[model samples]
Target: MSGEQAGWALELYQRSVLKQQKFAGIQSLLGDTAGKRCLDIGADNGVVSLLLRRGGGDWSSADLAPEAVASIRSLVGGRVERIDGGPTPFADREFDLVVVVDFLEHIPDDRGFAAELGRILKPGGRLIVNVPREPRWSLVWPLRHAIGLTDQWHGHLRPGYREDSLAALLKPWFEVTAARTYCKTFSELLDTALNFGYVIKKRGQGEGGSTAKGTVVTQADWQKGGAGAMKALYPAMRAWTALDGLLPFFKGYRLIVQATRGSD
Candidate 1:
Protein backbone atom coordinates (compact mmCIF):
# COMPACT_ATOMS: atom_id res chain seq x y z
CA MET A 1 0.00 0.00 0.00
CA SER A 2 1.12 3.54 -0.72
CA GLY A 3 1.64 5.98 2.12
CA GLU A 4 -1.61 7.79 1.36
CA GLN A 5 -3.51 4.53 1.17
CA ALA A 6 -2.05 3.38 4.48
CA GLY A 7 -3.03 6.68 6.05
CA TRP A 8 -6.58 6.34 4.79
CA ALA A 9 -6.84 2.81 6.19
CA LEU A 10 -5.47 3.95 9.53
CA GLU A 11 -8.02 6.73 9.58
CA LEU A 12 -10.82 4.26 8.99
CA TYR A 13 -9.61 1.87 11.67
CA GLN A 14 -9.26 4.79 14.02
CA ARG A 15 -12.51 6.64 13.51
CA SER A 16 -15.00 4.92 11.22
CA VAL A 17 -18.16 3.63 12.87
CA LEU A 18 -18.24 0.97 10.14
CA LYS A 19 -14.98 -0.46 11.46
CA GLN A 20 -16.40 -0.68 14.96
CA GLN A 21 -19.45 -2.55 13.71
CA LYS A 22 -17.28 -4.91 11.74
CA PHE A 23 -15.16 -5.59 14.81
CA ALA A 24 -18.27 -6.39 16.76
CA GLY A 25 -19.37 -8.87 14.11
CA ILE A 26 -15.97 -10.52 14.11
CA GLN A 27 -15.94 -10.91 17.88
CA SER A 28 -19.41 -12.39 17.83
CA LEU A 29 -18.33 -15.00 15.28
CA LEU A 30 -15.07 -15.73 17.06
CA GLY A 31 -16.29 -17.18 20.33
CA ASP A 32 -13.80 -18.82 22.71
CA THR A 33 -10.62 -18.13 20.75
CA ALA A 34 -8.52 -19.42 23.63
CA GLY A 35 -5.57 -21.57 22.51
CA LYS A 36 -6.43 -21.12 18.82
CA ARG A 37 -3.66 -20.25 16.45
CA CYS A 38 -5.14 -17.20 14.76
CA LEU A 39 -3.92 -15.10 11.92
CA ASP A 40 -5.38 -11.68 11.19
CA ILE A 41 -4.83 -10.75 7.57
CA GLY A 42 -4.96 -7.06 6.77
CA ALA A 43 -4.86 -6.11 10.42
CA ASP A 44 -5.03 -2.32 10.11
CA ASN A 45 -4.36 -1.20 13.66
CA GLY A 46 -4.10 -4.70 15.20
CA VAL A 47 -7.43 -4.34 17.01
CA VAL A 48 -8.42 -7.84 15.92
CA SER A 49 -5.03 -9.15 16.89
CA LEU A 50 -5.35 -7.59 20.31
CA LEU A 51 -8.79 -9.08 20.74
CA LEU A 52 -7.63 -12.53 19.74
CA ARG A 53 -4.67 -12.33 22.07
CA ARG A 54 -6.86 -11.19 24.91
CA GLY A 55 -8.95 -14.27 24.29
CA GLY A 56 -5.83 -16.34 25.01
CA GLY A 57 -5.12 -17.22 21.41
CA ASP A 58 -1.73 -17.20 19.75
CA TRP A 59 -2.22 -14.30 17.39
CA SER A 60 -0.22 -13.06 14.44
CA SER A 61 -0.92 -10.18 12.10
CA ALA A 62 -0.05 -9.36 8.53
CA ASP A 63 -0.46 -6.29 6.33
CA LEU A 64 0.80 -5.31 2.88
CA ALA A 65 2.42 -2.16 4.18
CA PRO A 66 5.44 -1.79 6.45
CA GLU A 67 3.90 1.24 8.09
CA ALA A 68 0.80 -0.72 9.00
CA VAL A 69 2.93 -3.54 10.33
CA ALA A 70 4.80 -1.09 12.53
CA SER A 71 1.56 0.32 13.77
CA ILE A 72 0.30 -3.15 14.63
CA ARG A 73 3.49 -3.88 16.50
CA SER A 74 3.04 -0.78 18.58
CA LEU A 75 -0.57 -1.63 19.35
CA VAL A 76 0.04 -5.30 20.17
CA GLY A 77 3.38 -6.97 20.69
CA GLY A 78 3.09 -9.90 18.35
CA ARG A 79 4.36 -11.58 15.23
CA VAL A 80 3.54 -9.07 12.51
CA GLU A 81 4.65 -9.51 8.92
CA ARG A 82 4.56 -7.54 5.66
CA ILE A 83 2.91 -9.22 2.71
CA ASP A 84 2.69 -8.27 -0.92
CA GLY A 85 -0.19 -9.38 -3.15
CA GLY A 86 1.31 -12.86 -3.22
CA PRO A 87 1.91 -15.84 -0.96
CA THR A 88 2.55 -15.14 2.71
CA PRO A 89 5.63 -16.35 4.57
CA PHE A 90 3.71 -18.61 6.93
CA ALA A 91 4.12 -22.36 6.59
CA ASP A 92 1.27 -24.45 5.22
CA ARG A 93 -1.48 -25.38 7.66
CA GLU A 94 -0.03 -23.05 10.25
CA PHE A 95 -3.16 -21.61 11.78
CA ASP A 96 -6.45 -22.87 13.21
CA LEU A 97 -8.38 -19.67 12.54
CA VAL A 98 -7.89 -16.86 10.03
CA VAL A 99 -9.64 -13.52 9.72
CA VAL A 100 -9.99 -11.35 6.62
CA VAL A 101 -12.17 -8.46 7.61
CA ASP A 102 -12.80 -5.59 5.23
CA PHE A 103 -9.98 -7.01 3.11
CA LEU A 104 -11.19 -9.03 0.11
CA GLU A 105 -12.55 -5.99 -1.73
CA HIS A 106 -9.13 -4.39 -1.75
CA ILE A 107 -7.31 -7.22 -3.51
CA PRO A 108 -6.87 -7.42 -7.26
CA ASP A 109 -6.09 -11.15 -7.39
CA ASP A 110 -8.61 -12.28 -4.84
CA ARG A 111 -8.67 -15.84 -6.15
CA GLY A 112 -4.95 -16.25 -5.64
CA PHE A 113 -5.26 -14.85 -2.16
CA ALA A 114 -8.09 -17.23 -1.37
CA ALA A 115 -5.96 -20.15 -2.45
CA GLU A 116 -3.15 -18.93 -0.24
CA LEU A 117 -5.53 -18.67 2.68
CA GLY A 118 -6.57 -22.26 2.09
CA ARG A 119 -2.98 -23.39 1.92
CA ILE A 120 -2.20 -21.97 5.34
CA LEU A 121 -5.10 -23.36 7.32
CA LYS A 122 -5.19 -26.61 9.25
CA PRO A 123 -7.74 -29.17 8.12
CA GLY A 124 -11.25 -27.89 8.74
CA GLY A 125 -9.87 -24.64 10.04
CA ARG A 126 -12.19 -21.66 10.08
CA LEU A 127 -12.04 -18.49 8.00
CA ILE A 128 -14.09 -15.45 8.87
CA VAL A 129 -14.35 -12.69 6.30
CA ASN A 130 -16.17 -9.38 6.21
CA VAL A 131 -16.70 -7.28 3.09
CA PRO A 132 -18.99 -4.60 1.78
CA ARG A 133 -22.18 -5.78 0.15
CA GLU A 134 -22.95 -5.14 -3.50
CA PRO A 135 -24.97 -2.28 -4.96
CA ARG A 136 -22.99 0.14 -2.86
CA TRP A 137 -24.44 3.61 -2.78
CA SER A 138 -22.76 5.11 -5.85
CA LEU A 139 -24.75 8.31 -5.40
CA VAL A 140 -22.84 9.01 -2.21
CA TRP A 141 -19.38 8.67 -3.79
CA PRO A 142 -19.18 12.15 -5.27
CA LEU A 143 -20.19 13.71 -1.99
CA ARG A 144 -17.82 11.41 -0.09
CA HIS A 145 -15.06 12.41 -2.46
CA ALA A 146 -15.79 16.09 -1.97
CA ILE A 147 -15.64 15.59 1.77
CA GLY A 148 -12.64 13.20 1.57
CA LEU A 149 -14.67 10.30 3.00
CA THR A 150 -14.17 7.98 0.04
CA ASP A 151 -11.67 5.12 0.24
CA GLN A 152 -10.66 5.31 -3.42
CA TRP A 153 -7.17 6.14 -2.28
CA HIS A 154 -7.02 3.04 -0.08
CA GLY A 155 -6.99 0.55 -3.01
CA HIS A 156 -10.61 -0.61 -2.90
CA LEU A 157 -10.45 -2.40 -6.26
CA ARG A 158 -13.97 -3.80 -6.45
CA PRO A 159 -17.37 -2.23 -5.80
CA GLY A 160 -18.56 -4.85 -3.25
CA TYR A 161 -19.94 -8.39 -3.04
CA ARG A 162 -23.12 -10.44 -3.28
CA GLU A 163 -23.53 -13.57 -1.14
CA ASP A 164 -23.46 -15.89 -4.14
CA SER A 165 -20.51 -14.13 -5.74
CA LEU A 166 -18.42 -14.24 -2.59
CA ALA A 167 -19.40 -17.83 -1.94
CA ALA A 168 -18.34 -18.83 -5.43
CA LEU A 169 -15.02 -17.11 -4.97
CA LEU A 170 -14.22 -19.14 -1.87
CA LYS A 171 -15.95 -22.39 -2.85
CA PRO A 172 -12.94 -24.06 -4.39
CA TRP A 173 -11.20 -24.18 -1.03
CA PHE A 174 -13.79 -23.66 1.66
CA GLU A 175 -17.38 -24.36 2.64
CA VAL A 176 -19.58 -21.49 3.75
CA THR A 177 -21.05 -22.29 7.15
CA ALA A 178 -22.72 -19.01 8.09
CA ALA A 179 -23.33 -15.65 6.52
CA ARG A 180 -24.89 -12.38 7.69
CA THR A 181 -25.17 -8.75 6.60
CA TYR A 182 -24.88 -5.62 8.73
CA CYS A 183 -25.38 -1.85 8.67
CA LYS A 184 -28.98 -1.78 7.55
CA THR A 185 -30.26 1.26 5.62
CA PHE A 186 -31.03 3.49 8.59
CA SER A 187 -27.83 2.74 10.50
CA GLU A 188 -25.68 2.92 7.39
CA LEU A 189 -27.09 6.30 6.46
CA LEU A 190 -26.63 7.67 9.94
CA ASP A 191 -23.08 6.37 10.11
CA THR A 192 -22.22 7.95 6.79
CA ALA A 193 -23.69 11.29 7.83
CA LEU A 194 -21.82 11.17 11.12
CA ASN A 195 -18.54 10.45 9.36
CA PHE A 196 -19.09 13.21 6.83
CA GLY A 197 -19.94 15.70 9.51
CA TYR A 198 -16.86 14.80 11.50
CA VAL A 199 -14.64 15.22 8.46
CA ILE A 200 -16.15 18.57 7.63
CA LYS A 201 -15.65 19.79 11.18
CA LYS A 202 -12.07 18.57 11.24
CA ARG A 203 -11.35 20.29 7.94
CA GLY A 204 -12.85 23.49 9.21
CA GLN A 205 -10.51 23.36 12.18
CA GLY A 206 -7.48 22.83 9.86
CA GLU A 207 -6.97 19.34 11.31
CA GLY A 208 -5.49 16.92 8.77
CA GLY A 209 -8.62 14.69 9.05
CA SER A 210 -6.63 11.53 8.39
CA THR A 211 -5.59 9.64 11.53
CA ALA A 212 -1.89 9.58 12.30
CA LYS A 213 -0.11 6.24 12.23
CA GLY A 214 -0.27 4.13 15.44
CA THR A 215 -3.05 6.28 16.87
CA VAL A 216 -6.04 3.97 17.29
CA VAL A 217 -8.99 6.13 18.25
CA THR A 218 -11.66 4.40 20.33
CA GLN A 219 -15.15 5.20 21.59
CA ALA A 220 -13.47 7.02 24.43
CA ASP A 221 -12.06 9.45 21.90
CA TRP A 222 -15.56 10.76 21.24
CA GLN A 223 -16.98 10.30 24.76
CA LYS A 224 -14.00 11.87 26.46
CA GLY A 225 -14.27 15.20 24.70
CA GLY A 226 -12.82 14.25 21.37
CA ALA A 227 -14.80 15.24 18.28
CA GLY A 228 -17.91 17.26 19.04
CA ALA A 229 -19.66 16.14 15.86
CA MET A 230 -19.19 12.48 16.72
CA LYS A 231 -20.33 13.08 20.30
CA ALA A 232 -23.47 14.75 19.04
CA LEU A 233 -24.20 11.93 16.61
CA TYR A 234 -23.52 9.07 19.03
CA PRO A 235 -26.97 9.02 20.61
CA ALA A 236 -28.71 9.01 17.24
CA MET A 237 -26.43 6.20 16.11
CA ARG A 238 -27.44 4.18 19.15
CA ALA A 239 -31.10 4.74 18.27
CA TRP A 240 -30.50 3.66 14.67
CA THR A 241 -28.72 0.53 15.86
CA ALA A 242 -31.71 -0.28 18.05
CA LEU A 243 -34.12 0.27 15.17
CA ASP A 244 -31.98 -1.92 12.91
CA GLY A 245 -32.48 -4.78 15.36
CA LEU A 246 -36.23 -4.50 14.86
CA LEU A 247 -36.03 -4.57 11.05
CA PRO A 248 -34.00 -7.46 9.69
CA PHE A 249 -35.00 -7.60 6.04
CA PHE A 250 -33.40 -4.37 4.97
CA LYS A 251 -30.32 -4.86 2.82
CA GLY A 252 -27.19 -4.06 4.76
CA TYR A 253 -24.01 -2.32 3.63
CA ARG A 254 -21.67 -5.18 4.55
CA LEU A 255 -21.51 -8.98 4.39
CA ILE A 256 -19.92 -11.27 6.97
CA VAL A 257 -19.19 -14.92 6.22
CA GLN A 258 -17.86 -17.77 8.31
CA ALA A 259 -16.45 -20.71 6.37
CA THR A 260 -14.45 -23.85 7.02
CA ARG A 261 -11.52 -25.09 4.96
CA GLY A 262 -12.44 -28.08 2.85
CA SER A 263 -10.75 -31.20 4.16
CA ASP A 264 -10.13 -32.32 0.58
Candidate 2:
Protein backbone atom coordinates (compact mmCIF):
# COMPACT_ATOMS: atom_id res chain seq x y z
CA MET A 1 0.00 0.00 0.00
CA SER A 2 1.13 3.55 -0.64
CA GLY A 3 1.74 5.96 2.24
CA GLU A 4 -1.36 8.05 1.74
CA GLN A 5 -3.54 4.97 1.97
CA ALA A 6 -1.80 3.65 5.02
CA GLY A 7 -3.06 4.31 8.55
CA TRP A 8 -6.15 6.23 7.49
CA ALA A 9 -8.28 4.09 9.72
CA LEU A 10 -6.13 4.51 12.83
CA GLU A 11 -6.00 8.26 12.41
CA LEU A 12 -9.76 8.44 12.73
CA TYR A 13 -9.69 7.48 16.40
CA GLN A 14 -6.54 9.47 17.14
CA ARG A 15 -8.37 12.44 18.60
CA SER A 16 -9.52 10.91 21.87
CA VAL A 17 -8.73 12.72 25.10
CA LEU A 18 -5.76 10.49 25.89
CA LYS A 19 -4.26 10.92 22.44
CA GLN A 20 -4.70 14.68 22.50
CA GLN A 21 -2.80 14.86 25.79
CA LYS A 22 -0.12 12.53 24.48
CA PHE A 23 0.45 14.63 21.37
CA ALA A 24 0.61 17.77 23.45
CA GLY A 25 3.25 16.14 25.62
CA ILE A 26 5.18 15.02 22.54
CA GLN A 27 5.09 18.52 21.05
CA SER A 28 6.32 20.02 24.29
CA LEU A 29 9.20 17.58 24.50
CA LEU A 30 10.09 18.16 20.86
CA GLY A 31 10.70 21.86 21.51
CA ASP A 32 12.30 23.74 18.57
CA THR A 33 13.44 21.31 15.83
CA ALA A 34 14.09 23.85 13.12
CA GLY A 35 17.09 22.95 10.96
CA LYS A 36 17.67 19.65 12.78
CA ARG A 37 17.76 16.24 11.10
CA CYS A 38 14.95 14.23 12.67
CA LEU A 39 13.99 10.61 12.16
CA ASP A 40 10.66 9.11 13.15
CA ILE A 41 10.95 5.39 13.74
CA GLY A 42 7.77 3.39 13.22
CA ALA A 43 6.20 6.47 11.76
CA ASP A 44 2.62 5.23 11.71
CA ASN A 45 0.66 7.35 9.22
CA GLY A 46 3.55 9.88 9.37
CA VAL A 47 1.87 12.06 11.96
CA VAL A 48 5.09 12.72 13.87
CA SER A 49 6.98 13.28 10.64
CA LEU A 50 4.47 15.92 9.61
CA LEU A 51 4.60 17.47 13.06
CA LEU A 52 8.40 17.68 13.01
CA ARG A 53 8.48 18.98 9.46
CA ARG A 54 6.00 21.68 10.40
CA GLY A 55 8.36 22.64 13.22
CA GLY A 56 11.11 23.08 10.56
CA GLY A 57 12.98 19.84 11.23
CA ASP A 58 14.49 17.98 8.29
CA TRP A 59 12.49 14.79 8.69
CA SER A 60 12.70 11.20 7.44
CA SER A 61 10.38 8.29 8.12
CA ALA A 62 10.76 4.54 8.62
CA ASP A 63 8.40 1.72 9.45
CA LEU A 64 8.19 -2.06 9.32
CA ALA A 65 4.85 -1.90 7.55
CA PRO A 66 5.00 -1.19 3.82
CA GLU A 67 1.65 0.57 3.93
CA ALA A 68 2.82 2.84 6.74
CA VAL A 69 6.13 3.59 5.01
CA ALA A 70 4.27 4.49 1.87
CA SER A 71 1.81 6.59 3.81
CA ILE A 72 4.60 8.50 5.51
CA ARG A 73 6.50 9.03 2.27
CA SER A 74 3.37 10.32 0.65
CA LEU A 75 2.69 12.68 3.54
CA VAL A 76 6.19 14.13 4.01
CA GLY A 77 7.83 13.66 0.61
CA GLY A 78 11.04 12.51 2.30
CA ARG A 79 13.35 9.50 2.41
CA VAL A 80 10.96 6.80 3.54
CA GLU A 81 12.10 3.21 3.89
CA ARG A 82 10.90 -0.17 5.15
CA ILE A 83 12.94 -1.79 7.92
CA ASP A 84 13.31 -5.36 9.07
CA GLY A 85 12.98 -6.11 12.76
CA GLY A 86 16.78 -6.37 13.03
CA PRO A 87 19.28 -3.48 13.00
CA THR A 88 18.21 -0.23 11.39
CA PRO A 89 19.44 0.64 7.89
CA PHE A 90 20.66 4.15 8.73
CA ALA A 91 24.32 5.11 9.14
CA ASP A 92 25.85 5.60 12.54
CA ARG A 93 24.95 8.95 14.10
CA GLU A 94 22.74 9.76 11.13
CA PHE A 95 20.21 11.94 12.87
CA ASP A 96 20.10 14.75 15.39
CA LEU A 97 16.87 13.41 16.89
CA VAL A 98 14.87 10.17 16.84
CA VAL A 99 11.30 9.50 17.88
CA VAL A 100 9.71 6.16 18.77
CA VAL A 101 6.17 6.79 19.80
CA ASP A 102 4.06 3.85 21.00
CA PHE A 103 6.21 1.56 18.88
CA LEU A 104 8.37 -0.23 21.43
CA GLU A 105 5.77 -2.66 22.72
CA HIS A 106 5.48 -4.39 19.34
CA ILE A 107 9.20 -5.15 18.95
CA PRO A 108 10.55 -8.37 20.39
CA ASP A 109 14.16 -7.23 20.77
CA ASP A 110 13.60 -3.98 22.56
CA ARG A 111 17.12 -3.80 23.96
CA GLY A 112 18.66 -4.20 20.52
CA PHE A 113 16.27 -1.60 19.15
CA ALA A 114 17.23 0.80 21.91
CA ALA A 115 20.91 0.23 21.12
CA GLU A 116 20.27 0.84 17.44
CA LEU A 117 18.46 4.06 18.24
CA GLY A 118 21.48 5.14 20.26
CA ARG A 119 23.84 4.16 17.43
CA ILE A 120 21.91 6.12 14.81
CA LEU A 121 21.86 9.24 16.95
CA LYS A 122 24.75 11.69 17.12
CA PRO A 123 26.43 12.01 20.45
CA GLY A 124 24.23 14.12 22.73
CA GLY A 125 21.33 13.89 20.26
CA ARG A 126 17.87 13.38 21.66
CA LEU A 127 15.49 10.37 21.62
CA ILE A 128 11.87 10.74 22.50
CA VAL A 129 9.79 7.62 23.21
CA ASN A 130 6.25 7.06 24.30
CA VAL A 131 4.81 3.73 25.44
CA PRO A 132 1.71 2.58 27.23
CA ARG A 133 2.11 1.96 30.95
CA GLU A 134 1.52 -1.70 31.71
CA PRO A 135 -0.54 -3.48 34.36
CA ARG A 136 -2.73 -0.43 33.95
CA TRP A 137 -4.54 0.73 37.04
CA SER A 138 -6.12 -1.93 39.25
CA LEU A 139 -9.54 -1.27 37.80
CA VAL A 140 -8.56 -0.94 34.16
CA TRP A 141 -7.50 -4.51 33.46
CA PRO A 142 -10.73 -6.03 34.73
CA LEU A 143 -12.78 -3.43 32.92
CA ARG A 144 -10.97 -4.00 29.64
CA HIS A 145 -11.20 -7.79 29.69
CA ALA A 146 -14.78 -7.81 30.85
CA ILE A 147 -15.72 -5.63 27.90
CA GLY A 148 -13.42 -7.29 25.32
CA LEU A 149 -11.58 -4.02 24.79
CA THR A 150 -8.12 -5.52 24.83
CA ASP A 151 -5.20 -4.27 22.74
CA GLN A 152 -4.29 -7.77 21.51
CA TRP A 153 -6.01 -7.01 18.20
CA HIS A 154 -3.40 -4.32 17.59
CA GLY A 155 -0.55 -6.88 17.90
CA HIS A 156 0.90 -5.53 21.11
CA LEU A 157 3.68 -7.89 22.21
CA ARG A 158 3.63 -6.79 25.78
CA PRO A 159 1.29 -4.77 27.98
CA GLY A 160 3.55 -1.66 28.26
CA TYR A 161 6.37 -0.08 30.31
CA ARG A 162 6.97 0.99 33.84
CA GLU A 163 9.01 4.08 34.57
CA ASP A 164 11.88 2.31 36.35
CA SER A 165 11.99 -0.59 33.87
CA LEU A 166 12.06 1.72 30.88
CA ALA A 167 14.80 3.79 32.52
CA ALA A 168 16.90 0.69 33.15
CA LEU A 169 16.48 -0.47 29.56
CA LEU A 170 17.85 2.74 28.06
CA LYS A 171 20.40 3.63 30.76
CA PRO A 172 23.26 1.78 29.03
CA TRP A 173 23.30 4.02 25.94
CA PHE A 174 21.34 7.13 26.90
CA GLU A 175 20.69 9.42 29.82
CA VAL A 176 17.07 9.90 30.79
CA THR A 177 16.68 13.65 30.62
CA ALA A 178 13.03 13.72 31.56
CA ALA A 179 10.22 11.26 32.16
CA ARG A 180 6.58 11.45 33.20
CA THR A 181 3.34 9.49 33.36
CA TYR A 182 0.08 10.85 31.90
CA CYS A 183 -3.26 9.99 33.44
CA LYS A 184 -6.40 9.27 31.43
CA THR A 185 -9.49 11.31 32.12
CA PHE A 186 -13.12 10.28 32.65
CA SER A 187 -13.99 11.40 29.14
CA GLU A 188 -11.35 9.11 27.72
CA LEU A 189 -12.84 6.28 29.74
CA LEU A 190 -16.23 7.06 28.26
CA ASP A 191 -14.70 7.09 24.80
CA THR A 192 -13.18 3.69 25.48
CA ALA A 193 -16.56 2.32 26.49
CA LEU A 194 -18.10 3.55 23.29
CA ASN A 195 -15.26 2.06 21.24
CA PHE A 196 -15.74 -1.20 23.09
CA GLY A 197 -19.32 -1.36 21.97
CA TYR A 198 -18.37 -0.50 18.42
CA VAL A 199 -15.66 -3.16 18.24
CA ILE A 200 -17.99 -5.79 19.68
CA LYS A 201 -20.70 -4.92 17.22
CA LYS A 202 -18.29 -5.04 14.31
CA ARG A 203 -16.83 -8.35 15.40
CA GLY A 204 -20.27 -9.87 15.77
CA GLN A 205 -21.08 -9.17 12.14
CA GLY A 206 -18.28 -11.54 11.06
CA GLU A 207 -15.50 -10.69 8.59
CA GLY A 208 -17.66 -9.36 5.77
CA GLY A 209 -20.55 -8.20 7.87
CA SER A 210 -19.45 -4.57 7.72
CA THR A 211 -19.82 -4.51 3.95
CA ALA A 212 -22.89 -4.52 1.76
CA LYS A 213 -24.10 -7.60 -0.17
CA GLY A 214 -21.10 -9.75 0.82
CA THR A 215 -18.53 -7.20 -0.32
CA VAL A 216 -15.32 -6.90 1.63
CA VAL A 217 -14.93 -3.96 3.98
CA THR A 218 -11.62 -2.18 3.83
CA GLN A 219 -9.96 -0.69 6.90
CA ALA A 220 -10.62 2.82 5.69
CA ASP A 221 -14.26 2.07 5.11
CA TRP A 222 -14.63 0.56 8.55
CA GLN A 223 -13.15 3.65 10.14
CA LYS A 224 -14.76 6.25 7.89
CA GLY A 225 -16.92 7.60 10.67
CA GLY A 226 -14.10 8.05 13.20
CA ALA A 227 -12.44 11.19 11.89
CA GLY A 228 -15.61 13.16 11.41
CA ALA A 229 -16.95 12.01 14.75
CA MET A 230 -13.72 12.92 16.47
CA LYS A 231 -13.70 16.33 14.80
CA ALA A 232 -17.19 17.05 16.01
CA LEU A 233 -16.25 16.00 19.53
CA TYR A 234 -12.82 17.64 19.75
CA PRO A 235 -13.93 20.64 21.78
CA ALA A 236 -15.53 18.36 24.38
CA MET A 237 -12.48 16.06 24.33
CA ARG A 238 -10.16 19.00 25.05
CA ALA A 239 -12.26 20.06 27.97
CA TRP A 240 -12.10 16.54 29.38
CA THR A 241 -8.36 16.46 28.91
CA ALA A 242 -8.04 19.70 30.85
CA LEU A 243 -10.18 18.21 33.59
CA ASP A 244 -7.98 15.10 33.64
CA GLY A 245 -4.99 17.34 34.24
CA LEU A 246 -6.52 18.50 37.48
CA LEU A 247 -7.04 14.98 38.84
CA PRO A 248 -3.58 13.85 39.97
CA PHE A 249 -4.94 10.80 41.74
CA PHE A 250 -5.88 8.92 38.56
CA LYS A 251 -3.65 6.15 37.27
CA GLY A 252 -1.58 7.08 34.24
CA TYR A 253 -2.04 5.27 30.95
CA ARG A 254 1.12 6.41 29.16
CA LEU A 255 4.81 6.96 29.90
CA ILE A 256 6.84 9.50 27.93
CA VAL A 257 10.62 9.63 27.90
CA GLN A 258 13.11 12.28 26.75
CA ALA A 259 16.63 10.97 26.65
CA THR A 260 19.96 11.91 25.09
CA ARG A 261 22.60 9.64 23.56
CA GLY A 262 25.70 9.15 25.67
CA SER A 263 29.24 9.60 24.34
CA ASP A 264 30.43 6.53 22.48
- Candidate whose lDDT is highest: 1
For model 1 the TM-score comes to 0.78
- Look at candidate 2 and tell me the lDDT of residue 36: 94
User: What residue runs in model 2 are displaced by over 4 Å at the alpha carbon?
Assistant: 1-16, 185-191, 194-223
Give the alpha carbon lDDT tens digit for every residue of 64-140 in model 2. 66666665676677688777556878999999998887678767788888888888999999999998787445555
Backbone clash total, candidate 2: 2
Model 1, span 1-264: residue lDDT tens: 345434433444445466677788888888777888988977666655655666787888887656567766766665888777578999999999999866677667888999999999998999999887875454444554676556653346776788889999997899999898888766666656766655655668686544312123443333435545544556666666668777676667789999999896
At residue 189, give the lDDT of candidate 2: 70
Measured on C-alpha atoms, candidate 2 has an lDDT of 0.70
For candidate 1, the 10 contiguous residues with the lowest summed lDDT are 211-220
